[model samples]
Target: MILLAAHGSPDRRAQALARGLRKGLERVLGVEVLLGFIEHQSPTLLESTLELGRRGGGVVRKRLL
Candidate 1:
């Protein structure tokens, strides 16, 4: 599983771009990709972390942007 963590921006375009980039990465990597925002967005890092733990009860490798 891959978590695509981004800093939330007030500009919606930037957030949309992040989503699109995350989707592209998923397609290219062919892996589970989860998106989370550092702030100003839903499903923050802590939420994502808990969800990931529930899905897989072990270590989760993370990549941040």
Candidate 2:
């Protein structure tokens, strides 16, 4: 599983970008990918990571900026 964390935005355009990235990662990794937020959005890093861990033990990578 891969966890992508970013500074979320209230702007629709920014959110769409984030969602696009998440989808791209999912396709590239061929595994479950989680989208998380550092601020605006919900399901933060901690929560996403925990959920990923609970699902199964696997690689957890984060792309944060």
Candidate 3:
């Protein structure tokens, strides 16, 4: 699994970009990919990391931007 940590934005364009990147990552990695926000969005790093840890049996990687 991969955790993508990004600075969240209220703008629709920014959210769309992030969503696209997340999709691309999921397609490329062939594993579960989780999206998270450092700010301005839900499912923050701490929450997502904990959830990923609970899922088990997968490597957790992060991409920050």
The top-ranked prediction according to TM-score is: 1
For candidate 3, write residues 1-65 as lDDT tens digits: 88787787877788788879989988997977888777777788678778878888355555554
- Residue-pair clashes per prediction, in order, are 0, 0, 0
RMSD for each model, in Å, please? 2.3, 1.7, 1.9
Flag clash pairs in model 2.
none
Cα lDDT of candidate 2 equals 0.77
Q: After superposing candidate 3 on the true structure, give the runs of residues whose Cα lies further than 4 Å from its correct spot.
A: 57-65
Q: Rank the candidate models, highest lDDT first.
A: 2, 3, 1
lDDT (Cα, tens digit) per residue for candidate 2, span 1-65: 77787788778788788889889888887977887787777778678878877888566565554
Candidate 1 TM-score, true structure as reference: 0.81
Model 3 clashing residue pairs (backbone): none
Superposed model 1: Cα runs more than 4 Å off = 57-65
Root-mean-square deviation of Cα positions for candidate 2 versus the true structure, in angstroms: 1.7
TM-score per candidate, chains pooled: 0.81, 0.78, 0.79
- Predict model 3's lDDT versus the native: 0.77
* Candidate 2 least-lDDT 10 residues: 56-65
Predictions in order: lDDT = 0.75, 0.77, 0.77
lDDT (tens digit, per residue) of candidate 1 on 1-65: 77777777878887887789779987998887777788888678778877877788433444443
* Poorest stretch of ten by lDDT in candidate 3: 56-65
